[model samples]
Target chain A: MKEFSLIDTYFRDVSFQRKDVLLGIGDDCAITQIPAGQALATTTDTLVSGVHFLPDADPKAIAQKAIAVNLSDLAAMGAEPAWLSLSLSLPNVDENWLKAFSEGFKELTEYYSIQLIGGDTVQGPLAITITAQGFVAADQALKRSGAKPGDFVYVTGTLGDAGLGLDILQDHTDVDNAEHKAYLLNRLHYPSPRVFAGTSLRRVANACIDISDGLLADIKHILKASQCGACLQLDKLPLSSAMVDSVDQDSAFHYALSSGDDYELLFTVSEEQKSSVDRVLACSNVPATCIGQINGAVGKVDLKFNDESYAYSQTGFEHFNSGESSNKHRNNAKRA
Target chain B: MKEFSLIDTYFRDVSFQRKDVLLGIGDDCAITQIPAGQALATTTDTLVSGVHFLPDADPKAIAQKAIAVNLSDLAAMGAEPAWLSLSLSLPNVDENWLKAFSEGFKELTEYYSIQLIGGDTVQGPLAITITAQGFVAADQALKRSGAKPGDFVYVTGTLGDAGLGLDILQDHTDVDNAEHKAYLLNRLHYPSPRVFAGTSLRRVANACIDISDGLLADIKHILKASQCGACLQLDKLPLSSAMVDSVDQDSAFHYALSSGDDYELLFTVSEEQKSSVDRVLACSNVPATCIGQINGAVGKVDLKFNDESYAYSQTGFEHFNSGESSNKHRNNAKRA
Candidate 1:
């Protein structure tokens, strides 16, 4: 089939039926209404086939991850998901691939109640770029530059499972248990963006970010922006049971600390609002745990292990590093 | 350089300083404030290497054209350009190329007073996907499905210069005058999005669409959505003097009818609003020309030359076409 027809068959009519969308697909541009006294938050992320995921990975998984990561950006800003525009490039027209991708996109958009406003599909190498937009109150949008010295650093859900999942998928790690393997793989392939948790923290958390680039690397973004330091207690690091079962302590620690793609919310709350944040997360789907404390020492990330200080060689993923990712697939399949 | 640092060094500080942007780059998401009673009009377009332009095309031209096309979509919707997010995928780091691209992007953003909110940069095949957001009064946004049968069809600027420019660039056409060649080439490389013309038409136009995919192809989009037909006068097509001097009459007409990449606005105006639209256009930089009439006949595009019926073999560009566009580079390069 042709490109336009392919879009008509797969991408059209896939909206989640958002009421704020005045016009959807097939227009010059999509039209949406923003609520009064609210600010619009938008984020764009592009996931390349080889760089971001396995070339042979499932289309549905790719679609879900693509949307999730962009949505995670919104969540980081304490924005409620609203509308999205997807720009997809493929080598050729594959009906089955498109079908699976649409299903995955439809599922996530429905879950988030975000309508797919408009997009463009082209003939090229595989890549998915999604621009996800959301709304936050004028005064309630979370920012990274608001972390105070007295703030308690907290993270929602566990970290490193998705990064480990990548290792397992690439067969670089010896993960014996199938259940643990499946759980980690799911975490890697279908991460749930911390949407509700972010909205809940809007008025409670002083600063926020979603952990996509490992705990250390991403937290540094907060520190750099907020001009504060952090003391992370490694012992308090949250880990999924599957992560613990599938890897050794050192590997698990490495994954949780330096590996990436967790999609969990990492936020800071001042001493005054710590109780309020705790109350908010008590009813959230994923549990929240205090893992560190912000300090006056700017740009410092002091890692503590059983009251002793330590450091690691690597922080997180960097696209232009001379070294390759240890999680790269061993028998990497050729792109279809 | 790392991806984040690359973005900071090159893409950061490229803003038009629009007051609506609350927060821009360096955050998880860019925040912008939309005024009360305004609807957000958004459009996304991707220009791929060898697909949208020559593989070795100037980075500045690529950046400018990419931004311009997206802005044209907003203009078609009668939305004033407000903010933008650019997702750029590059094959590798080229500092010279990056500098030129930023200059091109910055130039246009400054011209339209559109702020660069935020975006993503990645290592992949060379492609630029820009999502442009604009605002229009809730009741004044133009749509493609509003034209009546009696509306007079009009188009802003000349129709075929940019289209023929591609042919000239590819050595498919020739002109004796360097000035003519340069003019046509400039149109292709730096086509202006009719932002002000569109805003003026918000109340005057019954339906509107941008002429990106040729006059016939894009105008048909309006007719199809509005459930009407059109009669286009071939003789009345506004061809640049350079275009006429550069190519044969038949080829120029064909380019005007079937070639793409002219970012002019095609809108329909009712009899009552025709005078107002003319008044608005009389003092404009680019002139608008009345070229056709909408009809009750559905999905029909009857062409006439000096009051005689005519037909063309092709409609417009289909991305998945078997034939390569002439604008494609001689030694077609592979995707990175």
Candidate 2:
């Protein structure tokens, strides 16, 4: 069928356009009015099938992840989630699949008090895209470009749990311990977004970023944007007992330092405000660990382990690398 | 690689959680403060490879169309385009592909003067999602429900050209003539957005929609929302000379009424305001034709053809139906 015809059959519902919607689906554009005093924060993301998720992965997980990841972006910016639009590409329209997907999407949306403002759904291989919008007061935002030399670097919660979870899922890691297995699985299946902590950190964080990339790599982003470097104390890396118990101390350290997907916040604060930072994090009821200190050195990140410094070869995850598919890495090593 | 690693490599760089960005990627949410007296009109669309376009379709066109379609949504709302976020899913991190896509994206962004703010990128089937933001004056935006009985139904530009172009691309019909074929192809390749017309209509037209779906189906949305019906004068339907020369009158009528993807503005204005509309259309330099009138009848659309009134079959394009593939329709019949 023609593109327009396809849109009409599957998408053109009057319900898609609401009373609050100044314009909707059929137009060259849709218009909206934001209430005064709200600054608009916009974001977009594309999730490819097979690349972003398993082809047969649960639709609910997929939907939840889509929003969660986007919401994480808003959190980093200290913005409040307001509305979102979704675009889906499917091989075909499976009613059961759509119902499940929408249910999962609505669940997270309602929980967060976000509205499904507008989006387009179409046919193709399974790909989902979402554009999310949030509101925040003007000037109250966290950015990667504001870190200065001598700032104290901090991270919320533990790092590398998601990465460890991924390692566990890639192979049959014989974790006879059920609790440990469940913990790892939970990390993989559901990630807690540090929204509250993020909101609270707006005033204190000189620079902030979420650790979707490994902490080292993500810190590089802040350093590059802020034009500084950092020296992380290896012993200070925050890791869970479960993660440490699953592997050797060295491997656990490696994971905590380099494995990605903790979804925790890595931020820098001025040295004079270190106590205030600690107090704010405590008041907000989230773990905040000081891992390092920013320095004036350019393009260098030092890891001080024991009395000597260790040089790392790999720079965290690179999208098309062939050296170690997590699955393959699991088969070669028995660390977990 | 795990999903988190994929996101970091490809998507993290997209966010700039700066002051204007109140919230940005990596948080549980992002928020924005809307400027005073501006209402936020938002819309989203998803495009999947092989479903929305041929797998080999130009990346530039795909990128351009992705943003253009969302902009079309903003236009439908009679809102001015502002910011856009993109979610992309790709199979591989092919630098060449990304470079081309970004180039295309940047081109249209410059043309439309919209900013690429933030979003996530992940692995999956080639899927693209974009959420676009636009602004309209508070309390003065147009809506579909505003159409009233006795309002003159109007459509800007010609219709059905996109459908015919699709037919040619699918090789469903032999394009014995070149000029007519070029016109059709151009319509499909570069569908112009009627932003000026739509925004202008906000001041005068009772309601409006963009023709992404066929005329009959789209009009149904207005009718259902307005609790009214319409009687379209088939002969008054706008058709290009090329379309008329290529197809018979009846078939041409079918294309004009049911063929979608025109991306032109279909709107309504009060009969008492006809002269004013004419003057406005002339001043705005957009060609428009009055094709019908809204009636008190609830949820019905009738067509006047050859002095005989009949109900439109209400069939054109749909995503789920199997009988009318663009290729099949074009190959099976020389309808246009």
Candidate 3:
């Protein structure tokens, strides 16, 4: 079948039964109903072959990661996922690849109750762009600008596993532990969007952001937006047992701080809200730890271990920072 | 500058003063307020280097066409354009290119009262995926399924100019009339989205579609969805004087029926509603001509040229039809 036919056959019927979706596929435009007094939230992410993922990566993994990363944006805003539009650029028609990709895309979207509303298929280098839309009540939506000077910083889930996973995939690092390799690889390929934790933090998190460009880089966005600084305790950084087993402590710390693609929530909460934030995270059954505090020195971020400041090898991932060799060093391992 | 910094420098301050957009750029997700009792209309389109346009094509024209095609979809649905998100993948960073592209993007969006709410830019091959959102009343959106057996079919503006433009670009056709070449090239690169005509025809048009994939192929979509057929009068198809002067009558008809990217609205109205439709079109100051009628015979489409039948050499553009040599033939003059 042709590209259009392949979409009709595999993707046209994968609607997730969203009540808010008035129209799905097969139209010039998809129709959606946003509830009154609510604001619709939207985000888009494009995953390109060789840049965002391996050109020979599994189709299922590619589709899942694409959807998950976009969903993570909605999660950072404390919004409820409702619908998505996909634009797929392909080098050629491959039915089996498309089937696996759609299945993986459907799997996460179904779990989030997001209907696949519309899509455009074209011939080109392989790239998948997904626009995910959700709803958040007015200013009740979380923003990076909401962080306060006295707020405590927190992150959901363990970090560095996905970064280590990329290292493993690129054959840059070797590990003898089979279980560690498997878990790290899963973290790299199928990092879960922290939706439950993000939504719950709407009442607690003063500001929120999803860690796609590493903790050091993403946290700086919150600081810049809120016009504040942060003091982080490096020893408090959370690392999965699998990541700890795969790499040394220093290597693990570097990955946790500078690696991208973790898809975890990094947020700040007021001193008064910290207890409630902890309570909510516990209730959501997501592991979270306080690792820093927002400070008065605007736009400054300091990382230390027990009051001893340590020089870092790199800051974080930035797509346009190719001039600085350190950024290349960061991308090499994180994007392996 | 970093990727996020580049976005902040180039894209953040373009709020467009949209009152409904409570939040735009800088956040994880943009926030929009949809009025009560209204449905949000969304469509996505992806344009790739080499496939959609030459890699060396003007960035301004590329940006304009990208937004225009998506707006054309909204126009087909009779929705009022509102918000849009852009996902841009670039092979490398070039400031002059980005500046020209943004200027072109801002030009059309400013006139249409649409807001650029959010975007994601990454390093990769050149491809742009834009998702446009609009608003329509509940159950009032125009659909291909609404056509009836007795509906009179009409098309807005001229057909086949863009196809001729592509022919001119590829050096496939040579004409002495420089004026005609200029006209055709403009039509190809900047075909106006029929926002005024489409919205006005909401009450009169039983069904509506934008001509992206030629009259014959696009009209078939209407027929397929409405479970009907159509009989088109080949002689009545609206063609510019330049088009008629540049090509023979048969060639003009072939491009009108088989080429793509006209971006005109092809709609059907009941016979009784034809006068009203005409009146609406007149008030909107857009030229439209009746050329056919819907029929009761399901899926049967017949074209007649002054009482004689004609066979088409091509259908429409399908991305992955290249395995068949005929697909390359279709792409030749249309995509050149």
Candidate 4:
């Protein structure tokens, strides 16, 4: 089939006219008319087969997570998603795969109210690249450099669940319990994007970041940007009940501190405004935990456990540093 | 070395402080404070090794073209580029490659006055994705649907040089010329982004699009959006001197009208604005040519050569439908 005919039959439904979108798909470029008082926040992410995802993973999950992770970036900026472009490279066009993928993509786009603007489709190993564009008011957007020394550090939702989910998926540990399996599977397959929680914190949080690279690593980004250090108390770290029940206390601590893929928000609030944050999150039914406090600008990260300070291993994920392709191995072992 | 340290060492130098950029690289997300009176335009493109480019192509040229192609999308919307985010996937952490890539990237960013923003780096097959953001006044951004019947169409620079350059590089064509080869190579390796021409067109052109997917296919997009049709004068199609000198005139026509990757702006302006466009291009040293005009809604693309309508066999490129991998027999025959 020709490219035009294929697009007309299958991908044409992806086009829709919107007042904000001056031009949708089927153009050399997509154009939008941003309102007078709004600013645009943009981000791009590429998920390569056998690199970022498993080669034979569920297309629905892949599509959802591809857009979800990028939305997480916009969430960190406290922006409202408006438009996106996709560049999908596949070995071949499989009808069933495209249907499932589009279904997954359309659902998330509708949930976020983001329009599919323009995109390019190509032939290659399965690779999906999504660029998400979001909007924010001129003075209302959040940033990573706004945290001060006296700010109270906060996190939305529990950490380490997604990482533990990966462990369960890989069968690294045998879980005979059905509910435990289901919880781990959900965490691995459909990690939540903290857009609502992030938007709510726009006026309250000093600085915000999405935790894709674990609590310690992601929080360090806020520290580096704000030119501050942090003291995270181990006892205050939040972990899922399934994670805590399945693993030993020390293992739970390690997972909570260093496990990645939990798409939650880590933010800092002023010490005086801590109660307001608690009240806001409680009303919204989103869990917000005060894990630590920003300290002096000494360029250090400290963790305290059981009234003792010990040097914890500071490893989350490092791409291309080691010979092993860790993500690929983890995914392949699941199939095995 | 870990991913964080590698990013710090290689990507640390891509820093700039602009008032409009509220935040930049090294943050969870880059935040921009768009000027009050402007609308934001955004786009993303992914170029994979051995797919969009020759696997052995220079890293400098790859970096340059990656930014240039995305900037071309902004220009199509009559937007001026302000920021870019790069998601790079490499097989290894090669210091020399990173230095070269950064240097090439920096040159283009500085030339365009674009700031580096937040992105991710991972280990995978060599692929580079960039999301570019630009700004224009709220009502001044161009769209594909603004062209009206009786409007004169125009294109900047010669077309098909990039496609012909690919032919020469692959040894499909035996042209024994040196300077001509250099020119074609430059066109393919690093096509200029027509920013100045696009900015100037904001005052005169009714609609505009950048030519990435050949004239016939791309012009169809404009026609579809504008609810109009076009009768392209094939005889008036512009061809580079080397193109005509190297191939027969009829073949040159095919290359110019059907070959893709020109990266020049194609636009429509009412007849009354011809003199203004001419004057602007003359003063700015930007080449502009008129080859066609809009017609009534006919729902088809037509071409005329010597007052006789003609049809060509080839359309623009469709990456998935191209049968590139399946054509291994043809490649083998050529090699033998």
Best by DockQ: 3
lDDT agreement of model 2 with the native: 0.71
Residues B1-336, candidate 1: write the lDDT tens digits: 898998999888775788788899999999999887789999999999988889889999999999999999999999989988999998888999999999998988898888888999999999999999999986787898999998999989888788777776776656668888789899999999998888888878999999887788787788888999999888999988887766666677777877789999999999999888877765546689999899857988989899998766667777777766634321221112
- Global CA lDDT computed for model 3: 0.86
The candidates, ranked best first by DockQ, are 3, 1, 4, 2
Better of 2 and 4 by TM-score: 4
lDDT per residue for candidate 3 within A34-142, as digits (tens), equals 8887899999999999888999999999998999999899999999888989999888888889889999988888888789999899988999999999988977899
Question: Which of 1 and 4 is the better model by lDDT?
Answer: 1
In order of appearance, the predictions have TM-scores of 0.96, 0.89, 0.96, 0.91
TM-score attained by model 4: 0.91
* CAPRI-style quality class for the chain A–B interface of candidate 1: medium
Q: What overall lDDT, based on C-alpha atoms, would model 4 receive against the true structure?
A: 0.77
- Candidate 2 error regions (>4 Å): A1-35, A322-336, B1-34, B92-103, B310-314, B323-336
DockQ of each: 0.79, 0.47, 0.83, 0.53
Candidate lDDT values, in order: 0.86, 0.71, 0.86, 0.77
Q: Model 3, B240-276: lDDT tens per residue?
A: 8778887777778877887788999999998788889
Candidate 1 segments whose C-alpha is farther than 4 A from its true place: A326-336, B324-336
lDDT of 2 by residue, B182-257 (tens): 9987787667777667677777888887777688878887887688998889988999987887877766677777
Better of 1 and 4 by TM-score: 1
Number of clashing pairs, model 2? 72
lDDT of 1 by residue, A239-266 (tens): 9988777666667778888778899999
